[model samples]
Target: QRLLVTIALEAARVMEEGIVTDPREADVGSILAFGFAPYTGGALSYIDGIGAKLFVKIAKGLQKKYGAEFKAPKLLLDMAEKGETFYERFDPY
Candidate 1:
């Protein structure tokens, strides 16, 4: 479960930071392009669902509990501290 979540989260980061321009597009692509879990609501949605702060906190725990592979990125840390979601931070509109 944790590994799956981490993969989703990192995929989200890749999209939000550079790959994709729109949050909605990323969410849609995750479903159509990767067949990601619909219930999880794609990577960004999963993070948003948990709240950025909580997501980072959980990722940090996972990092220690599992390995460095689960480490939250700097962007995540910054967003978590500032209470910004990926949509809020990366939305072009």
Candidate 2:
């Protein structure tokens, strides 16, 4: 969904921005700073566990059913299509 995509993108940005390198640290920050469900192990973990491609597909469906905000960003779509994980593309540190 939009929530997952937003988290993933934000996590990616954090990594791209050289804020952190370890995904585990990113997850902790997301949960602590953003309050991203500690039970799910942060946004990146949630997306990775649920599968980015699947999440994007579901999000696209939601976008059609809901509104523009649900629309997955191109970066997400490209990442999903290419099977690229956030950590693979970004290094916060």
Candidate 3:
């Protein structure tokens, strides 16, 4: 679960950095190219499934245990604060 949160935070960072233009593309590509957990529907979808608020909370715990690498991106923090979801915010359509 914590690892998944980390993955979500990284995915969020990539999106925040404009490395990936769309959330669905990032999600599908990760699944097909990197074999990122298909059950959770890739990183962004997993965060959406878990909800940003909870994911951030988990990420915070992991960050405390692990290090700065677990830090949540500004995009994710903003999303959690606004109660936003990846698909809703980064609509692929």
Clash pairs detected, candidate 2? 20-92, 20-93, 21-93
The lowest-lDDT stretch of 10 consecutive residues in candidate 2 is 84-93
Candidate 3, superposed: residue stretches over 4 Å from native: none
Q: How do the candidates rank by TM-score, highest first? A: 3, 1, 2
lDDT of 2 by residue, 2-61 (tens): 565667657755665567667888899888888787887887777677777987887778
lDDT of 3 by residue, 1-93 (tens): 765676677789989999998998889877787678899889899999989999889888888998999899999999999999999998888
Estimate TM-scores for all models: 0.81, 0.66, 0.91
- Candidate closer to the true structure by lDDT (higher is better), 2 or 3: 3
Clashes of each: 0, 3, 0
* lDDT of prediction 1: 0.76
Judged by TM-score, which candidate is best? Answer: 3
Give the best candidate by lDDT: 3
Clashes of 2: 3
Error of 3 at 83 (Å): 0.2
The Cα error of candidate 3 at residue 14, in Å, is 0.8
lDDT of each: 0.76, 0.72, 0.87
lDDT ranking from best to worst?
A: 3, 1, 2
